[model samples]
Target chain A: MEHAVETTLTVNGIEVTRRIEPRRNLVDFLREELGLTGSHVGCEHGVCGACTVRVDGEIVRGCLMLAVQANGCKVETIEGLSDSGELARLQKAFHDRNALQCGFCTPAMLMAARDLQLKNPKASREEIRTHLSGNYCRCTGYQAIVDAIEDVLHG
Target chain B: MKAPSFAYAKPRSLEEAFDLLERPGAKILAGGQSLVPSLNMRLSSPELLVDITGISSLAGIQVGRTFRIGALVTHAQIERSAEIRKQVPLLAEAAAHIAHPAIRNRGTLGGSLALADPAAEYPACALALNATLVLLGRKGERRVPAGSFFKGLFETDLRTGELLAAVEFPRVERSAFLELARRQGDYAIIGLAGVADGSGRRIAFLGAGATPVLAKGASAASSLEQALKALGNDIDPPADLYHSSATKLHLAKVLLSRAWNTLSKPH
Candidate 1:
């Protein structure tokens, strides 16, 4: 077996320099190496959105990516969703509308939602559902999550 | 919870990336989503993992009479690309339906094509669009047509040390449709993407076979009924854990049916 190589990159607007195995998963790197555990690891096979995060302003599955691939790239985890310890509107909506249950998928979900809103600020309910259909929430049955996004969209 | 150790290489250039790729027991890390999981499962134990992310020149979208997309361009970039949206709407639609928002952000076009899952949308998009795949290695660069790209399940024409550089798709002013299952972030059990540009059409199916298979009959069909029937017959879907190839074949028919309807409609 080959050993992992060490490298550094930016995470959530902060430059994080660390030596890691070249093959270290972005999910593990974020959670274990960087200690940003907000990005959960669910299926690890990219089927579950629990490990979702943003790389260079785009939402992506952390588990599906390798840490080395993120070298010199800008990454945003659920931890970086807010500035100055304040939650973004989407976070508040998710909290207010009760969009989470186990909360394992919330970080990725919020990041994905944030990406969608960035692309289309006034996205319709159907558009949100269409864009967010990839992130799964087995606990909430998705109504509350959809409702949360709807509230934010309507507002 | 530790990954099996692997030697890592950060190639500074595309040539270096290709050189690293040519070595035995080497795997290229593009987006890393698919390759990392395979590594975690111990299904594929490559001794050396090439980090191509350092080669910044490989990431970008080039629009032209025939658009050339760098392999490193992420799915999110493609989905949000105004040029791709205007020129290759089917590709955009397919990219939009990929795993999830976060996955799209990191997953690269080249990486996904290299992974070559039967159910992935990019391969099917490539096939439907008749894209050209550009490969780099110690020798030089070569372009492979979409039809010849996939060799089998989880396989492609990629050599041990070769790197995929870019995918060139012919710009088509046509109507298209993409339809698939909602296993929600799971690989599609079935997917259909059809491109129709007045004179001829092309239909591609994913998750229905060992590789991305083109239903050329559907593309060759001059009428809607013929196109649907061609799609139904052309797809020899293989049975997997998700759905039997027979069931997927039936689903392929339905998906192509919808795609054909949308494409053949008077616009």
Candidate 2:
């Protein structure tokens, strides 16, 4: 079996190459190899959205995607979105609404919220709840998170 | 949890993919929404991971008299597609009931069908629509009717080295998809995907059995009351952790009633 596979992909805005085990998922690769720890690994499965990241302009569970599968793809983490100021308004809304508690699911929640904002800016409260359904925030009961996202969308 | 050690190969063509699949313990990797989770949980451990996403031919949607959706077409694509909404509205409706935006973004129709999860929407939708699955292998290509494609739980009739290429759904004028889940993105406890055409109605139920079951007895019934009564003869859904078998049957009847009403109404 081939233990190490060479993979090259653009993360955030920079291109990096590494020889990693095929079993290594995208989240672990980003956090361990590239030192981009903004994306959390809560479930290591696709259920929780804490490991959400944008690949080729679409948000996907980072833990479900292998690093080698992301080869030649443009990968964006929560760090990238924060650094690019793409999450500025959403961050502000979250700050104002106190959407986060313990800040475990905040990064992925923001990533998912920004996706909804870009795709459906005029999304209803129900739609917001539905869109963020995969992102489980045990704290805040999601009311404050929904309020924060609603503020960014329509407020 | 982490996936067990495995070799990965991204094949850009079907021939290369077939060659890789011929290797021992080779597993095809599609969207990996379900497979990756199983891999992390150590439920599935394949020695070789055959990454088939690089094959361009396996990803597209074509609509005409029949809607042909490639196996790799993601749920998000189906949900947002105007063409799908205007043509196969049932698919569009069912697509929204899938996990969520993130899972839909990565989960593919082929993966869902190939997995044959009784709680999934596509299998029931395919059975209701009488869709045809295009299977490609080393020798040639073959088409399997949706009725016989699903074998059992987490099982399909797809032969070894055969890949689900695309699904062809005949256009229908009236169709309805309804599911009752605990949460927005949770798997359906009981779901129905039904379509009415000139031949009659075809109703399929998910989470009713080991496979997506076509409710023949209820589908052939002329009236809603008869259909509701016939549902008992059609399915005997197994009990889950939360819901009783009797509760599931009741919920299935509820969905059938609503779908019957919707299909009976003129568009």
Candidate 3:
């Protein structure tokens, strides 16, 4: 069977179409095809949240969704979010709190944090911890990450 | 790691989907939360991926005599739905325990039930609530009770060329869902889903066996102490890497006691 399929979708605010392999995941499509490398790929089996991105206004594991499956969908990566200035406050807070150590989990952490901010701005400390539980940050022991999100939520 | 090469198709209707399923090595793709990971890990490789998310008929929540949830309903949708929170709150509570926000945002109820992971939250909830699954096929539709639907680990009665269209749940006012995991989003080491109705209590456990195990001995017991004792007869949970069989059974008792207290209380 032929593996490549024509897929068209909007990234950030631009619509792009490409003929890609059906097995290529959304993260790879964003990085290799569109030259958007903000979303990192780690533990490709979906255990790690490094490949987190927004699809149709909801955060999802990029590796868990195929590029062909995202046909006609709207995708937003960290670069798009950063350029939009929507993550300014959270990014500042993360910097202020030194939330990142190795910095590998920053993009996904910021995405998950922003999601919580939009959905529940008044989220408690426990809620912040729980919401970010999926995004693994082996550095700073997650204390500073939680502190950063809390600052954005209540600061 | 990346998924092996495969053809893909997104069918807009069940008829079209069934037609695609006729192809050799065709596999249904719902949320792909579990399937995609397996693909990436080389655990499963199919010739064609039949993306069923485009099918409109298989997505929604309907409330009548029984609460009906479409197979395409995502876990996040279930967690945030006011109707599900009101009618079948156990499912809503259970949904919150499934993975984390991102996984929940993409994982579907039908996908979870169809996978029948034994450690997943929906199967035990379905068993506890005595839910009925709606299976659609080329021939017609068939309704299977949750008790009979789950065959074993990562297995279900879902037949070849058939799709789990929806699930019908009879509303039970009193129910409790609890699980013990090392972390918030990790799979439960042991979990309990309990429901109390006029008939009596239906207690089901996840991560306790190859399939969701109904604690018949405990459900039939009249008191908490007796129920705790009877639980021993109901299940013999296999040990995982981190826990021993004895430890799992002990944790199962702890959850049962908590659920028993909650269900026994006057509503």
Candidate 4:
């Protein structure tokens, strides 16, 4: 079967057009087609949060979304969080607190935490724990991850 | 893993999506969090995927005396919905407990309901709240209550070419609560969610059966004691890898006890 849907999506403030398969995952389209490798594909089954990204102001697992589904939607990846050579404040907190070990889960963790904080600026430690429960970090640096979120939430 | 190659369509209207579904082997793409994984695993090999994201009519929260959630509403949409919180806090609470931020962000309420994972939260919420699922197909819309939604393990009564439009939850004077395994994003070993209308009660159990289990008869009990007793008689959880059917039933009983205790207590 073949589908030729010519559509344009404004991703991270950049408009791009593609005529592609509807079954193509958004993560693959981002990494393979658009060359946006910031969104890593881990546990494509949705267990790992490494594929996390923001779609139209919401954090979503890129691996699970179809590229065609994101038509006309705004997407923000880790690459979009920072402008030029500087890092976002949360990035600084993550580094200061040693939140990342393998660094594979950093982008997704950052994206999820960013959404969490945006929704609840004064989120408590338990709240952060409950919210971040969806993103799995195999390196077991959850304490540091929680600490990093705590720093941003409290300080 | 790359999903099997398939045709794609982004329908701008629900009518368009419905027309597209009329095509054979067409699958509706709501959030794609669940469906994509299934497709990649070769669990589903639909020839056409109708991306309903372009159908703006299928999104958003409709507030009223009761809450009606558009089928396309994401997990995040349910979690942050003020109308859901006010009308059915348990549904919001269950949405909050769904697999982490990323999964919730991409998972849709209708998709989850259609997927009908025995361990999924919305099923429990639906069972406990006695919610009605509104489905739209070539024949038009039909309503199925939560009790009849689950046919078996990972199965639903949804017919081919049918699109889930919304879920209507009847308002009730009650408090709600949920308890799941500590797997952290994984399906719970056992889950119990309930709604207590002061004296009467409604309890739904997950992880105890092939699908979300309900003890609706017990929900009408005049007291927690009666409800707890009736629940044991109503539920028949199946044995599986995580737990035996007996164990799950026992867990349901225990959780029902806990739910009753929580619901019967002061706010």
Total clashing pairs for each candidate: 22, 0, 0, 3
Q: Write the per-residue lDDT of candidate 2 for residues B112-206, one digit (tens) a residue.
A: 99999999999999999999999999999999999999999988999999999999999886899999999998999999999987888899999
**Can you write out model 4's per-residue Cα lDDT over A23-113, one digit (the tens) per residue?**
6778888889889999899988787778888888878878788787777789877788765322377899999998999998888888888
Measured by DockQ, the strongest candidate is: 3
lDDT of 3 by residue, B167-244 (tens): 999998789999999999899999999999788899999999999999998998999999999999999999999999
* lDDT string, candidate 3, A75-105, tens digits: 9999999999999999999899988888999
Candidate 3: Cα lDDT at B111: 96
Q: For model 1, how does the per-residue alpha-carbon lDDT over A37-122 read when each residue is reduced to its tens digit?
A: 88888776767678877777667777767787777788887787766443478888999988999887787778777777778889
Question: Which segments of model 1 are wrong by more than 4 Å?
Answer: A1-4, A11-14, A82-88, B265-267
Model 2 residue A5 CA deviation (Å) reads 1.4
Using all chains and alpha carbons, the TM-scores for the candidates as numbered come to 0.89, 0.98, 0.99, 0.91
RMSD of each: 2.8, 1.1, 1.0, 2.5
Off by over 4 Å in 2: none
Candidate 1 local Cα displacement, residue A55, angstroms: 3.2
- For residue A87, model 3's alpha carbon misses the true position, in angstroms, by 0.4
lDDT of 2 at A140: 52
Is 1 or 2 the stronger prediction by DockQ? Answer: 2
TM-score between predicted and true chain B, model 3: 0.99
Say which prediction, candidate 3 or candidate 4, comes out ahead on TM-score: 3
What's model 4's lDDT at B203? 78
The per-prediction i-RMS, to one decimal, reads: 2.5, 0.8, 0.7, 1.5
* Residue-level lDDT tens digits of model 2 in A1-155: 36788899999889999998989999999999899999999988788899999999999999999898899999999988998899999999999988888999999999999999999999999999999999998775599999999998998
